[model samples]
Target: MTQVATTDRALPFDVEAVRADFPVLDQQIHGKPLVYLDSAASAQRPVAVLDAMDRYYRNNHANVHRGVHTLSQRATDDYEGARQRIAQYINARSACEIIFTRGTTEAINLVANSYARPQLGNTSEIVITQLEHHSNIVPWQLVAAQTGASIRVLPINDRGELEIDQFEGLLNDRTCIVAVNHISNALGTINPVNDIVRIAHQHGVPVLLDGAQAMPHTAVDVQALDCDFFAFSGHKVFGPTGIGVLYGKENLLEQMPPWQGGGEMILSVTFENSTYAGLPHKFEAGTPAIAEAVGLGAAIDYIVALDIERIAAYEQQLLDYATERLATIDGIRFIGTAREKASVVSFTLEGIHPHDIGTIVDSEGVAIRTGHHCAMPVMDFFGVPATARASLAFYNNRDDIDRLVDALHKTKQVFG
Candidate 1:
């Protein structure tokens, strides 16, 4: 264990110091120090995030935006303040453009239901890439089925990069919405979202970007990208679960009908016909995740304080080191070797199932995600059922990569 300074000045955002801030990272798993390498799935929360949530629950635990009481005002201020922070973090035009949801899945569902269903009829078509997660793919499929619209998939090359030429070819006047991921969760491929948005706008189609993976490693400016809609989960960015963000252009959100109708989403209610609330409240139905939103706010503050560019550089170094080490292993074969990628490294060992490799790694206190990672189409494209994935974060170091490689060597010996 290392002593971490609470002082504001720290060089390179010390990995050991950051690790110390996360209490869970100090513990031993299976009698060995825990090496968390699955941050792309979910990141470990620091003391600051945990303490913020705890302080909120202990001192101010009340529903937001309904009551005129003091506690309600405080809670509502905190909740809405989180929205403002998210707006600034992603550089959206206004706070009204940001809506809170359970996570990235609900955000996409909101767009699919509110925007796509009514506007897009039988003749319309929705385009997506083959590398999207189930969250991004399934909702569009459901909307297409119900509305009698067609679904089109943009193919990817063997390196797991989207075929940009094919993507351009797929867009046309009939395309209603283009949904794609900013970064592939399974393959770590960072798609050219700016180009994607520009191409869709040229065809008069709205684009929705799933930033669940990209938000953690890169700075996302929705306004700069000129994307109509963007969705991301808080848990992937070191915040609590059951909280996420959905950013949409104000005019677009205003035009779309409410997806889920409940208490807060309405303006005036009558049995005959009820009026809906304005921009964001129209989309956020029921009581929102109050404390979780506060935790997410704290998480954003933590990341912003550290500066994203430095964190990205450090994580890339770890990625390069891990890639070199893994390439030296005789039976290891890397998957998704895209030129522009995030910190995720997915690979397979000859004559071994991904599940078996994951089990062996876990025995040595190395946590790596395995299986299709909720992207079955990506797996099918790579001609494998699944691959072992070791996703890196800023706090991880070369020693973590060493642990994974050593565990993999032990796995080969055991199976041989």
Candidate 2:
């Protein structure tokens, strides 16, 4: 319930005050002040999130849902309270719609195994975009491999935006589901999800949004978008890793079977047959990441107190500045230049591998993610081996971008 300092929402957001909350950002790395900009991979957790997890373990540590003891009740309260916070974070219809998973990977896999597996037949198809992370893509491929269903990809244009014009042509009576990322992690393109959902719904196909990158950067309301399923990871939103949410429409969840079988998911078991539990618990089986869930709840509280719309605006400003600053570097080519973007910049310097760029930048205490970004298809389409990415957060300042630019200059100097 700690607020991340109200910095007069009218002004450009106070980035320093926001940075102060993340103690990990305070220290120097390799004798230079750290300019940690790799937020798209995983955001730094605030002290608020840290303390929340610590307090949960210290005071209310117990097995959830089964025990009738005092600690169990409190643990259950904390665990389920976290679920409520997640529901509120995304404006889900009910708390029951929120199911806990290890991360976005598990959440998508859960939907694939539980929902998509049974629904998809030999002739059925699953529609996805070229912009999907490996988490989003691999699950459907596994589903396709298991079921006789086929996978169709919606192509991205040269600008790295989803080609919405060609989207409808890929859909037909055989389409089972359309899963796309809310924001491309590799490109930072904000996909037009409302339009995607609307078009998919027209074909009577449900849609799932991979929202791991989107939840941290934008305001998401499941009801407003009317997406059938949404998945995101806690670590991407300044929460602890190994905890995430899967939000599904109530009616659909009621129809889908359990993805995993174990302790919490079962109602009763006879030798012959076993009955399943209801709604979310039906999906969340075994001992969940209880402390991580508490941390995620605290992270949501922190993000909410700061306000997401204002966060988005401030981060947009940072993105603009970073883009302009990086473009000044000689021999640099930008990737994924969509008009709509989050605070992530993906690019490469001429004749310099991204790994070398990352290593050189790290020595100067500037951190940036460099790889295919788990979107190998994206890399393939762009005809590049990999990209160097500087993903930002609200906590980042212009100084971080400046340091990154300086480090890249040094990289070029070394190459020269």
Candidate 3:
């Protein structure tokens, strides 16, 4: 956001240098060099993030914001310092807008209950797109079920891109909120959130963006997008798991009730009623993920140091190369071919199950995610059970894609 680290003085992306930071990428799998292509699922963290978490565990293992001891202070600082770093990274108006959660799933769920449920009525509608991951889809379903509101889905074209022409028609007086993914994890289709937000706001409706896939790939300025709520996970961005962020506009967050109740979320607890804390802390329920938060901060540091512009360019090259090479393979029907996309490639082979493709690739030490990619609706639209997805990261090189190609050849041979 504010800190995109895209200065012209930044150095070119040294692929080897970036690769060296992730020690897990150096190892072998199934007696072959590992070619990790599953970043869309969970990215491998660099040593900086790992070390940061390790340092916190070793030197500052204590409950945060509840004690006067030195360790407690250290832990609290580390945890809150992470919030500040994340806020700065995403260019939030204030650190108070960032709420920590288990992951994007919990983050979206928090808004579903706290923000949407109370506002929705029998005649209300929640608009989401077909490109959404299940995390984005199911939360709205639950809230709509509770409030007797209906869920309206914006359809996607054959290329897996949202049919932008239809977006305006979907929003009416009954539409309360529009939730869509910034980038589809399954299809890598980058949705036009600017248009989505502008049109939704014109109808006096708020928009929430599922930004899990977009956070790692691009510079995200929430203020620039002007979305009401944005959710993303740290694990998808080379940070530790079990830590994520929900960024809401200050005015909207102030009006919403706390989704969960417990210590730290409350200012005072008594027999009469418990008073809630303000801003971010009100949503963070219990002893938060301190080490993970610190690791997430370090992950942001690592990404910043490398410069996001270089990373995006390098990854685009990888995607282009992989797409060209994979197109050479026979019966390789691309599931999603959006003009604007991230590094993800989802495809299906003729008469070959995605699981079989994944299995054969694993034997070659090429790891890819093979499933509906948490977007079964996407699969249903394409009339496929699942797809083999090779998602690229900045650390990935041409050799990784080559290995995947060789593995796919083997899969085809085995199937034939």
Candidate 4:
């Protein structure tokens, strides 16, 4: 770990040293120094993650699990090594519980098709919260349509937080699964997942958490949360894209059938008899994302070195600073005001479209996310078409927030 000079900053961690690790942040955007604030969508990667992927492709690029040569063995080791690191990162019981997919969307869809679909009957119900991203919601909807099952949505309060009481009432004997986001990508509301899991367990329901937005900011212990299944994306964790993880309990994975049937997932194949492989591989079909997995492992290493607890505390400070600064602007209404949140600030500027805000900000070399943020239902609940979202990460500093506020003022000026 590279150690830099310790300064008298609000955070104990060295933000300057951390920012130095991200090479992309060094460049200018639109002839101005870039201030990236859209980490919830996808975070910028560190040099370590980039180097790991490059090393894998250059030295250990080969198909895994069926290798006879030296390259094959190395590739298999690196790939499975990534899985082990991921398992440890999330505190999974074993590496066999970590199934790789394209991203979180595919992970949720796998559970929807294999686990939920088989158990669901005509009268069965799948319960999900309004805070879920489209990835979590659409899959269950598709499975429900196929199996003649019904979908039930747990409501959220005006503050954009999940209604725990409503969620408890929605779970019944007929409920097949309870799916929700660990943190809202659009709102930054941290759901009470521990309570969710405990309540669902009482009704004999399994809970699946979409941890895509949560992985980058906070520490997640699957064992501690006691969720039946958890899904997260690699790209959001400062890793390369196209690789993600789906963790399932040992017993549940053994019973669930494979969602896709292709190369790596099967043990023995025949015209009449095709037996599937065990736990993790049973779900991971076709050629896996080898280089991306190595990058994800490197990303995990970076986070472990930094210490997630410290990162979370520092980011909360950033969120607070940004919120306080942005609040001074007139006609600025915050979208999510949950007592508990991560490093996301979403709001609407009166008499201005979010798209225009995003466009104007980009000109000033300040990046922000604009739109319904793939949670259109949240937009409907707030009665707004879209919002301007500035999400932070460990790398972001006070300067980034200042630039964003200045850019918003410019947007207001232009719109007027």
- Where is model 4 more than 4 Å wrong at Cα? 1-11
Clashing pairs in 2: none
The weakest ten consecutive residues by lDDT in model 1 span: 1-10
Candidate 4: tens digits of C-alpha lDDT, residues 200-314: 9998899998999989988999999999999999999999899999999999999999999999999999999999999799998899999999999999998887888888988
The TM-score values for the models, in the order shown, are: 0.97, 0.99, 0.97, 0.97
Output the TM-score of candidate 2. Answer: 0.99
TM-score of candidate 4 versus the correct structure, residues matched by position? 0.97
* Alpha carbon lDDT of each predicted model: 0.91, 0.94, 0.92, 0.92
Query: lDDT tens string, model 2, 86-152?
Result: 8987899899999999989998998999889998889999999999999999999999999899999
Model 2 misses residue 57 by how many Å?
0.8
Off by over 4 Å in 2: 1-3
Model 1, span 134-253: residue lDDT tens: 999999989889989999999999999999888878987889999999999999999999889988888888899999999999999998999999999999999999999999999999
In model 3, which runs have C-alpha deviations exceeding 4 angstroms?
A: 1-10
In model 2, the worst 10-residue window by lDDT is 1-10
Summarize candidate 3's per-residue lDDT along 1-416 as a digit string, tens digits. 22222334456667887788888999899999999999999999988888889889999989999999999999999999999989999999999999999989999999899999998999999999989899999999999999999999999999999999999999899998999999999989988999999999999999999999999999899999999999999999999999999999999999999988898999999999999999889988899999999999999888888777778999999999999999999999999999999989999999899999999999999999999899999999999999999999998999999999999999999988
How accurate locally is residue 242 in candidate 1, as Cα lDDT from 0 to 100?
96
